[model samples]
Target: MGRYVRADGLDIWTEQVGTGPDVLLVGGLGDTVESWHFQLDGLADRYRLTAFDNRGAGRTAMPEDPVSIETMADDAAALLRALDIPSAHVAGFSGGSIISQELALRHPRLVRSLVLQSTWPVPDAYLRRWGLFIRWLAETAPAERTFLEGFYLDIYTPRAHNDGTVDRFIEDVLAFPHKQTTENLNRFLDAVLDHDTTNRLPDIDVPTLVLAGGRDSTSRPELGRAVADAIPGARFAVMEEEAHQPFQEIPDEWNARVDAFWRATQTRTT
Candidate 1:
């Protein structure tokens, strides 16, 4: 069932699946809980997976003012509190990873383990340019096909495009109901561009696993390594055949890696 959790004056759309140790799934820019559909069944048997749509995305209400990563982090923490969850293993993708970092930093007690996938600690010139390009596309050609095609070009590898995987992905994206508005897209882009957590990463004390896609030009493997290196004892792994969205591209492999890391963390804590 779908429910709304009030956080930071916004009604955030949240969904919970399975019943076990809590795992919070935070999606990327313009992504909703639906984006984690591939992971729902994969991790459900071992975890009580909770996912929510960030402000300005999905069924969640847009903020009256521009929102920052810190604000979104607080929103995530607030959602957990509202649900009476004391702590959870947090996994975040792309922009969501930045929010996850802030969550761990600001609300340490709320995060038990961290998974940062296709993430960057700070925005470089290349990333800034790409963010601007996405904003331009959102403003000029916000059609489903245009956006999906652009995303396919950026997030998937040539192997995926050659094997009709991109075609299938486009169809899936078109079927999704909650599409971000141009204004909200721009706002999200702005927030992502402003995100800088390089200096704060060392403060994240939770067990962390940084997953990088070798072919990810969006946030490159090097960036993921940097994030892992900054965090005291964070472990880093690269999915050589995947691109930005490894979880979607290689669900079985992705789920296995995450499950192994979560289990290891649990063992260590116990």
Candidate 2:
């Protein structure tokens, strides 16, 4: 069953599966708990997997005020506290990874380990330009189809685009009627552009794993490397054939790597 927890004055929608050490999964910008559907059974057998919609996404209530990465991080921490979970292995994708970093930095004792996927410490000129383009598309596009087409172009590689996978994904996304509002999208984009955790990365003492997609044009592999390099003792790996959404593109490989990383950390701590 699913439930709601009050965090930062909003009702955050949350769900859990299986039973073991907790593994909190945070999805990317505009993503909901459904985005992690591919991961539930794969990891839940060995770990208690929890996934929640961020403040502005899915069933979570959005605050009228602007939100920051720090605020979102605090939401995650608060959710854990509400559930009586002392600490857990936290994994985040894209913008969610930024929040994961802040959660670890601000509440170090609550993060047992970290898995950052397709993440960057700060936005570069290329990323900033891409963000601007996305914003422009969101504002000026004539239809939702046009916007989604542009979005898919930016996120998926030729492997997905050439094989009709993009079409299926787009169809699925459009089927959701209560999509993110333009105001919330702008707020998220602003937060992502302003995110900078390079200086504080050295303070992250927990075991960390950074996964990158070599073919991802949106969040480049070099950006992932920068994150891994900044965090002391963080390991980095690249899935050459994937793009932004590796977990969806290749679930078995993605789940195996993450499961292995968590196991390694558990062994070390024990």
Candidate 3:
């Protein structure tokens, strides 16, 4: 079952399942908890899985003001506290990775471990390129459509694209009611563009796992390694034949890695 509560003045919606250590799943920009449909079934039987929509997306409150990953991260902490969960394993994908990072950095006590996927330490060049793309996307429908089409190229292998999975992803995005405002999207893109966590990576004290898709262009496996290498004890892995959305592209393997990591961490803690 699911519950809705206003935490820190924002309407927060969440669903909890399973019976083990709490696992909070955070999705990327313009994504909802529904994004984890595949992974949920894969691991819920072994985890107290909690998935929710980020602010300004899905069923959560979308305030008039802009929101930052830091604020969103705090929201995450508040949700846990409200649920009486002292600590939990936090997992984030793509843009969600930024929230995960800030959560660990700003509210260390709430996060027992982390799973960061298809993410990177923000660099100025990355931000600049992203800004240009967002601006272009806002200006031209042709460009936006092109951008959406090209987005798959960055994340999936040629083989997966050929198999019609990538096509279905685009269809799903179109099917979802979620849509970001030019202002909200811009601010978010700016935050990501301005992000630079390289120096602070060493400060993360939790047991971390960094994952990347072999064919991902946005956050390549090499970048994934950089993140893993930055964390003192973080482990890094790559999903072969996969792209940006590893969990969606290869659900079985993605779930296996997540399941194994949580299981090992749980054993160690208990």
Candidate 4:
């Protein structure tokens, strides 16, 4: 448990383990730094891992009206600068991936390498439909099973979704601190949907690893392919039998691939 003051007047909650090249882990929407619990423990022995909650989630201060992806990217850059880390390997899952891409694009000097997982470049169709669902849930089903069911379908393996495992999943989400305000959630979701770096991806000089889940319905395989195709020399990998929560579903495989990717990139850079 550690706290770092960000440049944006927000006291960020962060935790670190091990000591090596910095590896910053950012979670998706409404997800706390605790969402990377498995990754933190898995990578702690080998790399310097930093996991933190974004604004409005976990212990971080929630700033209103100023929570765009650009601002979130700025927050990430500020976190690194505050740590005196000139550059670091950055990784994010789902919605967090947008912030990571923005950080790489807008604050290129602060990003050494990028790991994007279960993410897409924000397609218009997906945004229009899913964004509406988010708004509806926030307004009608705040903290209810309806929200969990829909979210699980979007973020979990089909097997998990079909297994009648709603209780535990809802419990896990309820464990986090969320406002369930449509405006707040929509503000973040819109920022994510509005962010598109496809045209600028080829210009990103940093090494990138694009990861996807074989069974992901939200950010499908095609999305991953598009991302890899856009970014020059970006490596793409899909976890077999996994979904949006691949890291949690298959920790061994996820860790092995992530560790290998980091080591290979580190060697190539050095």
lDDT of 1 by residue, 19-102 (tens): 889999998888998889888978898899999999999899886875898889999999999899999999999999999999
Model 1 residue runs over 4 Å out of place are none
Worst window of 10 by summed lDDT in candidate 1? 135-144
Question: What lDDT does each candidate get?
Answer: 0.90, 0.90, 0.80, 0.80
Quote model 3's TM-score: 0.91
Query: TM-scores of all models?
Result: 0.97, 0.97, 0.91, 0.92
Evaluated against the true structure, the overall lDDT of model 2 is 0.90
110 in model 4: Cα distance from truth in Å?
1.4
Cα lDDT tens digits for candidate 4, 40-158: 88888888988887877667767765678889888888888887888889999988998998899999998889999987876558645876777677678745667777667677776
Candidate 4 residue spans exceeding 4 A from truth? 162-167, 177-181
The alpha-carbon lDDT assigned to residue 108 of candidate 1 equals 99
What does the lDDT read for residue 201 in candidate 1?
92
Q: Model 2 off-target regions past 4 Å? A: none
Judging by TM-score, tell me the better candidate of 1 and 3.
Answer: 1
